[model samples]
Target chain A: MVSRRGFLQGGAIGVAGSAIGATSGSLVANALNNTAAETATAKRQLPFYGKHQMGIETPIQAVTNLVAFDLKPETDRSSMLRWMTLLTDDIARLSRGEPVLADPAPELAIGPAGFSAYVGLGKSMFIKLGMESDIPAGFIDLPAFKMDQLEEKFSGGDVVIHVAADDPIALSHATRSLVRDSIPFASVRWTQSGFAHTPGVVKSGVTHRNLMGQIDGTANPQLNSDDFASVVWMDQGPEWAVGGTQMVFRRIAMQLDTWDQLGTKSKEEVIGRKLASGAPLTGTLETDAPDFAARLPNGLSVIPDFAHIRRAAPEAFKERIFRRPFSYEAGISESGSVDVGLLWCSYQANIEEQFLPIQRRLEEFDLLNKWTVPVGSATFFIPKGPEPDSVIAQALFS
Target chain B: MKKIAVLLASVLLLAGCAPAGQVEISDAWVKSGEMSVEGGMTAVYGTITNNTDKEVTFVGGETAIAGLVEVHEMAMIDGEMKMQRIEGGLVIPAGESAVLEPGGNHLMLMQLTGDLMAGDMISVKFDFEGADSITLDSVMAKPAEGGDESYHETEMDMSN
Candidate 1:
């Protein structure tokens, strides 16, 4: 399949000077220069004003800064509205490559590079704002799981911002702009920066691999498909949250040292998929449906019962959640172990119905669990996108 | 001077047309004074578009939250970038814009009555040369990233 990113790249290369001598060294050099120029000058942008938030359904960017903020004691509904307005203006301007008002380094604001910012409200936000009754049903905080060793610093916040861009400079500027604007109303609780392969490095539409080397997000609902809309967008909720969804963000650390001890066969058995092609044990392609019932000559299932994929599979069609994950590396730990993990984010219309059941299964029994630890977890209710001339969650404020 | 002659000729030509239009300000915002104590300072920024056929001069402005206001500019003095008061005013050519931005020409508000928290709105009345005064509501906001350099280096003339 020609992925959207591939098509864009193809278009870009096609428009450049002709490659008359296709195999010539000079042609290759010229092509490389053109690609470099394209990466530098392409002002990619994602619209900030839309029916739903941009980052939710938008293709993943090269880098992300997931920041959570705790509201100050004095913050009230009125003050929250003001903060949202300020953030909205900042996001809108930064997404379009325009500097926010009083931007100190306006020059750094250039090149939006597909920049987008998503805002979500935690359970505490509604409580503190005296709007607990307005919290969308099924948007409660996740119950503690047996596999969790969640840290307080990374766990909870009143608000969270997911800022992403293809270019690190644009992402950094946008994140700083929003965080600085939030100073009066909130304080930074934690920040987790994650990255995927740089744009153009990976072929478009290829599923991203986690730090564990397993192809991730293989079973995700196709973007813009009806299945995705139903699974990821809220159609039944309070007026303020009709187009919003619930996000379950967990920082799962990988035990790469121990995982590396396993041979290819053991790793495949643990994940129920080929590490190289990401194909299920019973199939040849990543997109092929896993045949969980397929039996071996010894009468054992092709995909082991405790395999990660098997345990994570949805019991019912309604239980599926859309996953948009990124890998994070925080350098070596105190013990000299590599501190790397998956910043797993799953979006669903109802977290209770779609996400928890699958998570419960994984927590109970997944062979891959031995090599992964959940260290940080939080759930947030992302509100509907703002209308023109209004801030996000304007309905809730009203 | 040729510049003065052209200015006079344009004024005469505009006088023959319909009455001059109003000066408009947009994207108006003021820096939060939260970091500063009472009687401290902040700056206002926006684009002042002169829709009038004649040139418009922004002399100064006043806000209920500030004791004094002045037009200031960031200029390259010697080899260093320095902030100084614009002596006369900022001129916006007819149908052109004069941008009051950080690291550029701005309206400086000094002797703040109290801390201007983010999200607060202050009404500022702008005084113009040969035009009616315009009042606008500027939202208070913390400066965007990298916007603090000028504030740290500004050599304010407190006596003014």
Candidate 2:
């Protein structure tokens, strides 16, 4: 494993320092002298720092969802146990910010990411069983979950756990415990790194890259912005969890064969945002909301009703979830078939009340629904990770 | 005689050293690999060269881009990859190049200065050991894939 110290690069620090500096925009003028002449700066700073030590200053967090059902549930219990053990160990390492276990090793590995630390929670049977109906059809291993269906539905999950913390060591300890416990699981997904911010403040929008080359996630929600993070990140989390938020990871893959055929315009319309720039159809920028009621030259909604953006964010500030997701490229077959899609994720205090409504609405009508499929789906309720106390779900579920 | 010899040796070492304009930077911008032209706050990308023989310890740097710009390191703990700040700014070895690549090591530019045009470049000076300063450059490239051509071609260059 590459030691965290070894991966240290001065450039990263340089940028981080600058980010912290920029956030003090209001304070900057005050440092020297805030003149009554220069209109006193407005609303100091956005309270949404995420749930980590860095907050908006934190580099984009990459998440990968690896979901492989114990399809038969009867396929060699011993093998499943061993697989879970390996996965458990891997999760421990990942939570701590270590790389995936490999020979030569990928250039980038996983670590606790920051000093914020994290929590890894293993779901109890009750949550899993209850997931049967309310969960998306995809997680049930249905057609929508298949690489062909691309309906972006949930598939049943065999195991689920959430690992997150600002401090690498904290994440490590939690992950190690899971491994020692001999949990059964598989990593069917991974979150790539990137950030989406309000138009002028940060890199705005989800013009993220999919393995297939076309900018993916054009239609996904764009949270993590100051306004949203502050409003969306609930303060009910424990004190150590301050500056940190909650997270949900879903392993959803897209149908490369069919999606590659759609024109860029078709893809954009399906997502409700521009494919090239990620801007909302109705708004000038990606971070801006699409003027759903705004009419086009032909007198139609600028962003169509079935568009993902509209479905995902119906009421402006009424319902919002902080989203930091990644597009993955795994399970590619030689026969022109592939499993490449998003490691769908979001951060919120209440999943049932806050997140599900948007997801259900999307499932009902998103036009892009025809292009992406959710194969291996699992819901991991992550708490603001930090403090050596205990895992997040432990307190909530146990 | 020993004292004289020591003094002479010290003088030689100091004399041979050429002044490296306290690590200066010309162009600096912050963005992730997945940056866009139309995006208001464009992800910034840039390069920082030590330009000196002595190791340059990074204290911290700042910019007007976002509400704050932090030096973030992208690390892969186990399976989850996360970005964070190194307590003491990283150490830049003498006579070498340290790159801020996408998804790995980068400048988390927050509140931006202006609408980012694809070709536009921003400026930010770096503060290093002592009053040591380095003016570097942040070049806006095509939205990257976490790694660049130079990154893949010379994997062995990382003496680390």
Q: Which candidate ranks first by DockQ, i.e. highest?
A: 1
Chain B structural similarity (TM-score) per candidate: 0.79, 0.57
lDDT of 2 at A385: 33
True contacts kept of each: 0.54, 0.00
> How high is the DockQ of candidate 2?
0.01
Q: What is the DockQ of each candidate?
A: 0.29, 0.01
Output the lDDT of residue A199, model 2. Answer: 23
In model 1, where do residues sit more than 4 Å from their true spots?
A1-42, A333-336, B1-26, B35-41, B49-54, B62-88, B93-97, B102-104, B109-115, B121-125, B130-140, B143-160
Tens-digit lDDT track of model 2 for A85-168: 333233433433444332123234433443122332223222443422222211112223223332223433344443333333
Give the root-mean-square deviation of each candidate in angstroms: 10.2, 24.0
Q: Runs in model 2 with CA error above 4 Å?
A: A1-58, A62-207, A211-247, A388-398, B1-160
CA lDDT, every model vs. true structure: 0.83, 0.45
Number of the predicted model whose TM-score against the real structure is largest: 1
lDDT, candidate 1, A1-398, per-residue tens: 99999998988787553454455768778899887856663477778787788797877778899999999999999888888888887888887788776676678986788788989999999999889899888887999999899999878899999998888888898898888888878899999999877777766442587888998889899988999999999998778899899999999999999999999999999999999999999999999999999999999999999899999998999999989898999999788889999888999999999999999999899988899999999999999888656689987875
Give candidate 1's chain B TM-score. 0.79
